[model samples]
Target: MSHDFDLNSPENIADPYPSYARLRTEAPIYHSADPDLWIISRYDDVRAVLRDPDRFSSDVGGLESDPFNPGLEMPRWLTGLLSRISAVRVLLTSDPPDHTILRRKVSRAFTPRRMAAWEPRIREVTTRLVDDMLAADHPADLVHDLAAPLPTTVIAELLGVPTERNDDFKRWSDNLINGLLTGGPRIPMVRSAIAISWFFLRTIRRRRRDPGEDLISLLITGEGDEALSQWELITFCILLLAAGLETTTNLIANAMLAIFDRPVLRQQLCANPELAAAVVAETLRFDNPAQGLMRVTRTEVTLSDITIPAGAYVIPLIGSANRDPDRWADPDEFLLHRPNLGEHLAFGSGIHYCIGNALARIEATAALEEIARRLPDMAPAGTPTRITSPVLRGLRSQPITFTRTKIPAR
Candidate 1:
């Protein structure tokens, strides 16, 4: 079959399933000439690429252009600034030894214990946000009111970001992620990256002088060469803001949309709060927040009857893989009770698998439980807006409405 897939097209961005289905069947290892990237769409094929990191390396340093093709032409100075920012390699882009070291240092602070400890606080924050929405008016936007802020607030606290600078962190995160998803003018993205790097560097310096019980302080106080460098610390903070904030934000929003779209499913979840966890898992498979991720081939490799030359870009379409017919019975349907949800590549697989998966799940479960219990009757008040980025699948704004429950007198 002819390969005519356009990854950046609006039709694919709004609804990529049909395209993904066609690609998976016709050209599972199709190469797109426009982007000059190889696309892998089958579930097993995607899993194979993700697990075999040695062949499909994450270290895309020598690539001629940004794998996602942000489409920005920057002044040389801004380009240099972005280069300096990129130099502080985080786990997402690093492979093997470097990834291992960086992961260890960050893991010291981002422990399972710490994440478990945040559960109550996550619930408290969610309840408060729902309370605020309940008090304000009907037709509240779940994205802004709850989904966006909950993870940002929780992550800000974990990272020890000062309450006053929360807005800056969110703004910087949005700018960086937007630049990544849909490359626009280079200046704004470059400026935001520079500003955020400076902000994090300043915070790191403060943590050095006066260490506290936060992730940044932990990284600052860690010992040995394995410990994160000042620049690495700053970059990790930026990574955390993006990973922790954006992904979880979308998970909640996507889960809500899935539940609301199915009245019976919504009622079932509202009736049995335990089902909320299942709903989250199904959403991760049905409409994963991250649509795909890029990896560069270290050497010539053949996958699914096609030989991709060395240094070529290969993208594992996570969204498509999740719905692969061979893996999932009703690949496109949202099945809350679907078994073996652990099989989904939503958080990816292999060494580069998302480290914050646990935290994201906890935050999402808590948010969904709160919404199901409190806003059970909530329905879309207006057309939900989608984030028009090829790599990110999420709502830009999801306005919803329900009968406002009266706040009991304090």
Candidate 2:
């Protein structure tokens, strides 16, 4: 397959959805120019593959990636770390039995009842943040002031990390996530990972000595806590922090961007309180924060008339699938009244459906509601700066101007 698709190009990073759509329509499952993997787009194909762990694999080591191919010029330390840590992390990057086990352990901390318990706290924090933003100035960067902090705060509280430690968490997550790009001991990435890893190790040990109601503490004191080895605990905490912070942060930013981009839809959302869920669902479909996830085929299998060999890499384009024209009507248009919004693959589907979905939804919804209530006339002040990662889609900065300089405290 000789074609043009630049994964690292600045243009693609800024807006890959157009390319994803073209791929989905022309070749739903086709070999990439790199020839190392088979890229899968379209809603049915990606969702079906993600749903079946039997045919597809999520094992980090089993993944058919060559972040360190023979002549790639990749960083040595980064490759080494990738080869080592890939197999040790939590359920997100693992498969069946192990995935099930780790997910079960952490699942207790985020049950439906627990999510209900978190609602009040989420609202309180959101309101307080909005109050502070309003007090600061009218022309505020919503991405910095509202979108970023809300998720970070919620994730920190959930993990029992102190509010003061949020900067450390953000810094570490940014480095670690971006590190995956340069191939292993990417200095900043490794340093940040080591720092966070050490912090989690110390915190887990403290929890073991003096347990609390937080998720980390629960992981240390859960029913399977006795069976969990030390490495598992540390890896689990690291995975939690990575997903907990990054996913929700992007979700807020992406949702806000989608709403604000369409003035009519924004007006509808601001006017209709009951239709918030629909708006959120449409936002997820329109510009999903989690653009895609990589999977490996365990055996030679056929998907959508394309043959993928065993050990072949599979990139499921979530953002593309959410907008697949076959599955959605007027897929490109942002409609808050869209009926099939829940079917979107924003939180993913099947076993790997985000464990933090409820929390993310709560945090995102709170942000939108608060923004509508406090800064109804907030408008983008400049072109938003997008985060440069194919896997995670979001803005690095979004400057905005609100209607009033002084926001009321409700």
Candidate 3:
């Protein structure tokens, strides 16, 4: 407890589970000094913060999170303008009625039936991607060939946008996500955000005239009550694009990495490909993609009898919460059949649960199953790179070699 719980420390970023264990034991409501925030590492306490947005308003609190604007260097005027906006601008940075309305507008995006409609597309993309990856089989970078593009491609198709523009999406997505995670230059990501927003605005206008089955068109055609204003529509589209891409990309990459050094686990998955879901589930728990989400405290609050002052920043670490010793046995191990797996906060909980949860599950599952079947001997080719982030965790590049097997027909 005497040592600082440095969330972004090199050691913590390398392997936060140990520090997280110490946090849960020594300071359940630990506060970090560098960025000035309180961290809630225990499961019950984290769940309480996420589900209770009243005392911890995501609107004002969420704005300070400044996730999109890395280093949070916003002009005074822009910060002032955010309040007068018609609705909360972004889903990830909004709370209550506004957040509620925004989320509800696109809630049906990944429904069971809708997912069934897209299941074939998911499999097709996964198969084709895997085939393409295996064709270049010797020491392929899974992050490049497969994980990075699959979700973005599906999202593009889902939005009725052209996949040929994927290069632009990739560039924009990288700048935006990297900016937030790494505290890198904000100008590039801001430019990327503008470019993507402009693209979505034009697409939304087009969809209004000629509706299609894609998510954007569906949102365009949404009736009263669920109708999205121009601002809301643009924000929602950006959220879907960013969230859909990064979360699943990281999930698949992390899941594959979990089994990378463990040959027994890889071979186990090879024999029982159906355990793909379990692999994804345990990866989420073992190394969830979304490491932490920020919230600002509206009023004073207490956890484990420790007080968090009003207007303070709070981070309920999803990565830390899942691995809290109080919650699971052998908390660090990546067991595919960990009981009560759904309890993990990978997709989060309450009204803000990820809209793409089912899509991520199925997409990652499909990716895993096909890889197991085709590249059953997949192994790490070299040192895999970890993303240097306190809030997101996954490999940036993973060199993997695998046996060439005939691509299976769906």
Which one wins on lDDT? 1
- What lDDT tens digits, residue by residue, belong to model 3 across residues 284-395? 9999999887778888998779999999888888898899878888888887777788899988877788878888888999999988888788778888888777777877
The CA lDDT of each predicted structure is: 0.81, 0.75, 0.79
Show model 2 residue runs off by greater than 4 Å: 62-89, 137-139, 181-185, 224-227
* Residue range 274-353, candidate 2, lDDT tens digits: 45666666777888888787777889998888788988778888888988999999988887667777888988899988
| Predictions: Cα RMSD each | 2.7, 3.2, 2.7
Off by over 4 Å in 1: 62-87, 137-139, 183-186, 407-410
**lDDT, residue 170, model 1:** 76
* Model 2: how far residue 121 lies from native, Å: 1.2
Ranking by TM-score: 1, 3, 2
Compute each candidate's TM-score over C-alphas: 0.92, 0.89, 0.92
